[model samples]
Target chain A: MNNQKIAVIDHKCANLHSVIKALEIFKIDVKICTSKTELKDIDGIILPGVGSFDPAMKNLIKQDLVDSIKNLTFSGTPLLGICLGMQLLMENSEEGSLNGIGLINGTAKMIESNEEDIKIPHMGWNNIEINDNNNSRILNGIKNNDYFYFVHSYKCIPTNNSEVAAFTKYGQKICAVIEKNNVFATQFHPEKSGIVGLKIYQNFLSFIEIGK
Target chain B: MIINKGNILLTKRIIPCLDIDKGRVVKGTSFLSLKDAGDPRELSNFYNNQGADELVFLDITASSEHRNIILDVVEKVSSEVFIPLTVGGGIRNLDDIRNLLNSGADKVSINTSAIENPDIIRKSSEEFGSQCIVVAIDAKRNNNSWSVFTHGGRVLTELDAIEWAEKVNSLGAGELLITSMDEDGQQKGYDIDLLKSIQKKVNIPIIASGGAGNLKHMLEALTIGKSDAVLAASIFHYGKYSIKEVKDYLNSENVPIRLI
Candidate 1:
């Protein structure tokens, strides 16, 4: 396979350094693309976001990166979203009044805090159960019932049932992962999930390599 | 006190708190006569490899070393260990939180600052999300109840422990790290009463800190005390009990935990 570069889109509202550090362990070329001009000559794109929804979306728009990101993913450039970045791939969010990139037909809804005796942020190591039929490429070697680090209040609800790649039971059956063609995302912070989390970044880079 | 939420059980966390002074991991008896334990990066990597759920770095000398030194430590530890890292001590403003997060810290815990200016908690949570903000409360038994203590548990405050837990939770603190001054360094066990009291009032996750002698105390904190996670320093620092030993004991007690 030829050499590949992954663009980690920096919208100025995320813990981008951790994500970059995680990806760097795989020995793959990774760059933090801050503007649309920097999106050129990249095999894959990673949208890692934190903070609130409205401000993150506003930062993306202000940097003129929304259109380029949408185009890149629409053209089948493998894109991976982490945490709030995963939430922004949907149509809208309950966290704030802002339209998402509309890459997937879903809405990022708040995890019902009153449903059970669970924490709001769901901050801990919760295991994931993958759907065997649609084994996501990003989860190539990862086993079922493996734990990943999660710190989020909202989950993505894909309008299409087939988009669900994995399920993690928090207060209820929360959507943990989504995979639609070249677009993949995880609600958990694989960067902060230890050695198992680092395997995820490695797998994604290999996936991009194979696709290239 | 273990609430099983269905077939899926949330793994109980075992956190090792490192009291860093001048970039070196230090643990003292009652926070005095500090002695070097190990290098921050080396010890952090060891704990991460030993299956520590998360790591907490409290800069005991933050006021003196200030930003650059601790930021460098945080940067090194975060790069070496991939698990969630929580940095505490000397975080006074939003920029402190921003800089720590930018330096690769997963979360920042504020104790004295949060008590002095509660707006800092709200503003930090507002700017960087509650998931990355943790409030540390140092409490000491005051007659029938516990009072909040500040400045390395030197000065006493009028704020009630239970009330402060509720207040910070309302202000958008995702987690609470409550350390018991009376139980700290006793090595008998955690302050069960303090943990039970605060756990009853807050819906957010409570990390029970101080007073861990052995694996059984850690288990008791999780079982009888009903803490979401257990934080200890000397036991792990002085080579008394390894993180794996405590986790193995908790697992044997039927507490669901992620085995490394």
Candidate 2:
């Protein structure tokens, strides 16, 4: 864990400093990778993002990081996406026109409540309901319904139910954490979720340790 | 610390606002003379340790000499305090929001500028996201209803308080930070009617600001006033009540609160 480096890819749509600061708190060796060349020599990768999907994808294309991320994930590098980054792990999103990385068999859809009372962004602290049989190492040692900070309007709907590592309810049950093979993602901001968020980061570090 | 049960997201936030003048955290009486509270970094760390849900850093110095100092404080606080941070004061344009966000602020609040040009609310929220765009409303009771005030509650705007809140929410403002000018620094309690009026109009989270004298006042803001969170300065700054004490009080009353 000490020697292994985790690259937090900067697609120019994220508050990368907060993620860096969160990683730094646990003494995790982390770097900000803006391009393909910078992605080299990293054991693990964290794709963190904010804002709309179109602009996020545009920035990734502009920085020539689209293929680099795909290649690294294809090569079995442990990849973790946070918030909009997690939404990008799907094939498509209703929030934007451009297609996502298509790493998972899913599409991101808007979170609409049956009742008019539910808010749009689903902002604030929400708990996670872990999938019992997904075998998600990302949620290892975590409780069944531990709360994490979330702020997003769209949610990913996986084609295969097995990919759902965790689900959280806003208006309906939305995919909160998805895990498939080497790739893992969360729809919550672990960096902003306080102690439990740090614990989530620590669990990610443990994955790096197991790989090493 | 988040404790969630079922569909009810039961966590009422307690945010400690650090009013920064120049570089040091300062507090003023009726928005007049100021006195130092402590170093921003040290005070933030203390609050974070005491289980504060979030922190707000307001650059109280209305001058150009100390422009970049708050950014440094925000950067320092963001690194040490692992909670959501909202930065406000003198935020006028997209570049200002970008700079603050780049410096590690989770949210950037716009007050005077948002009222002057409401388009900035749409533009900034589109540029960033609704989650990070906070519109701070300083309202004073004007006859029948509250009126919007700008320039640190000095300049009064013709815009009605309730109308302004609805307008901003429609224009992509994620959250509303409503500060009652009448109740500010009075320490009696939050303007319950003011909070309730805005909360009814907008679906977004409302952070009740201004007066907060005791634990019961905060409870009223969360309960009767229906505010999502409560923001305060003097009560926490002068050691009248610790963050832990407040949380304990709220928790005892069955007001879903996160205790660290």
Best by DockQ: 1
Candidate 1: what's its TM-score on chain B? 0.96
Highest lDDT, which number? 2
lDDT for B225 (candidate 1):
86
- TM-score computed on alpha carbons, candidate 1: 0.96
Considering only the true interface residues, what is the Cα RMSD of candidate 1 after superposition?
Answer: 1.1
Query: In model 2, what is chain B's TM-score?
Result: 0.96
**How does model 2 fare in lDDT?**
0.88
Each candidate: what lDDT? 0.87, 0.88
DockQ of each: 0.80, 0.63
- Give per-residue CA lDDT, model 1, range A18-94, as digits (tens): 89888777767888898999999999999998877888898898889999999988887999999999998999999
Worst 10 residues of 1 chain B by lDDT: B1-10
CA RMSD, predictions in order: 1.6, 2.5
lDDT of 2 by residue, A50-76 (tens): 888988898888888888889888988
